[model samples]
Target: MKSFRLFLIASLIFITNNFLFSQEEDVVEDSTETLEVYLIDNYLQGENEKILVLSWMTNLPTKSKVKIEEIGTFNVSDTLTDFHQTKIDLSNVRFTKNEYMFKIISELEDGSSVESEEYSFLVPFEEKDTSSTKSTTTSQQVKTSSSYYIYNFALGITLWLLPSPALAFENNKTKFAILKDLPLVSIGSFSAYKTFPYVYFYAGYVHIPEGFVKNSFRLGTKYLYELPEIKHFVSLGLGGFTNFKGSNGINGEIGFSFLKVLKTFEMTASYSYNYLPSSKNKFHLFSIGLFTSSFSINLNY
Candidate 1:
């Protein structure tokens, strides 16, 4: 009986030690070898210049954060419930003109983390000489091209004739317009060979009598399409304007435009229909404007 008890006690001790060691292994952390991280470039949205966000993927689910070398810390990533792919916001970081280096650090609930290698990027047109007008112009052009490639522009005027008592077309409404596109026309000597989807802008006037129309000036965006192998183009737009008495004139304007870019300029025409309850009026405009090398139009953003 004594010998049997000794054997049992030894067996219990061995089992206990093995169990404790196995638990320690489970609690132990894994290295960042499974983490893959990189940076995305910034783009200008409206008047704001957006910062580059960090994107990463992991083989395991983990919490992530990004730290810039000198700028500051960013928000903790959305709880990475899944490890497939994620984008972390860099907007909170205050960035200045210069080169910057940043990294991604991923953590776990057990207080362990894996950090990424340093990544670097440049913020454009920052900290440059303010005296050189040429340098300033170049920088501004670069900024504009990065945001808008203005390849085509058009200016047109319209005459709207309303029949009156004596004159055949007595009340004449004279209006003017300009249409433009972000140019993806040519990259050096090579002409773009694809149908282009683009955005255009419109600014115009509708000359109705002061009592008939208030705030005839109009500005809006249009989606433009220019077909490859042909200079013809089409577009649609949704816009808002002041009414004859100065409220909301064109609440939802469905505009249709077709224009042909020529050797020197372009010829264009468009129709706008606004269907409001109990209202039966439409807008027709004809313009000679500039043309583009591609095709596109998107009225809703």
Candidate 2:
């Protein structure tokens, strides 16, 4: 009877001590604050003042600064903190046509540091003739686009005569690479190439892509150009292939194109070259296919 009573007393004491400790731990955890700084307000003010107001909120008192990374950490400026607002006085560097990029760095009194996201602001030039400036900008944008791209379409064929591994300069080997020659009925012999806002299909075989498939398919887009007066078009494209003779290699196509005006049916007859830099075998393909006129548009803002 005496032993049973002592055991019961010890059990009660143990339970009480554990409960008290657990409650104390919970209190300590709840007292800890989360380290966070949120940019609640950002704006510019004052012609004479030329001040930038970046207001932020935090759960604890913090010593804060800004880090500007143009090439490296070029500037670290102190902030005038009042409650939540940080006043950046632009009195030193008044009117300039340079964009200022900055990130907020805050160190709490609790020895924890937090960094805000990088932000940028630029003061656009004060133009004399805003309307003429707009017109010139629009014309320049159009000229830039036309210089880079022209709409053209063609039907073409590709041949995979040479097989090579898709090995980069590194020593690692490609996973899905194959060796030896494949019959004429291979994937790369036929392919459907598409671009923005248009779809075209091919009865040709789909080309086995090397290195990267997305990069290979988009190579055609870069080559699109048309001489609308003569209905003549030309394209130059290249793509990588995997499992080419148990290795990876690239293939290229050069297309001479034509389009029927009224119907606008596109056609391309291309000469394709397939070779492996590491191997001696070379393959040539003669391909012709029908497609639609390439589409292009220009935008001004």
Candidate 3:
């Protein structure tokens, strides 16, 4: 009878050990799969200050914590029980135009700890003031003005500079065809911050000329560096282009752009020199033009 009792106790001990080991293994797996947190705002504006929202999930009910440290400081922790909404105010934090990294850690009820992926938010400030009064005035002006006038103004300047029908004729015959190779158009959305550098995306017609008006469409990226005291920025961009005239060529350009962001309107002037190595027949077909000089009204969304 004593031997039988001893055997039963040993069996129970083995089963209990196995169950505890399995539980530990499950906890390890859960800790490895951490929660994800991200910044909601794509473009942060100065007037409407933005906040960092943290999100997470767990297999079991667990208490979590979030911490934010400015680029170079000790991590600060905040305990989070409710997983619904977590907010961090970034109003006073200042940053230059560079990558800002934040660390977040979450703790589980079982003493297992998990950390989030390194998340970054590009907080940008507009050098231009975005106010309702300025927007109203600009809106009225745009509604009253005709878009045709704007188009005509741009076309008229382009024609007046060259002023030769023969120039257009030559362009059609040679690889330098404007009509066949329509200048690539790009619609860009850009935002700037007073404390941070600015970013812009090119989507529409970005006129790229190789020599004697060779038209090409391109997708490009631009970065603007904010200067102290000055509202203008030094811009840099690089991108790829394909000619539409079936010329089969690729082009790259780099240039500097300046912006004067006013209370209501913004004026931008950019000068980029493009190089088309493929267009070089006998000599390198190198052409330089005033790439862009235009004015736009600031839009709020």
Cα RMSD to the true fold for all candidates = 16.8, 20.3, 17.3
| Per-residue accuracy of model 1 over 185-280 as CA lDDT, tens digit each | 221111122233466554544443332332355556666665544655566676655544534456333333255334433444445543223333
The candidate, 1 or 2, that scores higher on lDDT is: 2
TM-score of each: 0.32, 0.29, 0.29
34-78, model 2: which lDDT tens digit per residue?
766666656555544656677666555667766655433322324
Give the whole-model CA lDDT for all candidates, comma-separated. Answer: 0.46, 0.47, 0.44
lDDT of 3 at 92: 70
In angstroms, how far off is 288's CA in candidate 2?
A: 88
Q: Write the per-residue lDDT of candidate 3 for residues 1-301, one digit (tens) a residue.
A: 9999999999999999999999999998986754444333322333346565544444433455554445443323334342323556666766554345664565655577676666665654433346533332111112336877788677745532431111112233423322111112323332222432344445333332444434556566566565757755466666555566644334333434344332322233433344545664221222222223232222221
The TM-score, computed over Cα atoms with residue i paired to residue i, of candidate 1 is 0.32
- lDDT score of residue 141 within candidate 2: 13
lDDT of 1 at 24: 81
Model 1 regions lying over 4 Å from their true place: 1-50, 82-97, 109-111, 136-301
Sort every candidate by lDDT, greatest first: 2, 1, 3
Residue 171 in model 1: shift from native, Å?
72
lDDT of candidate 3?
Answer: 0.44
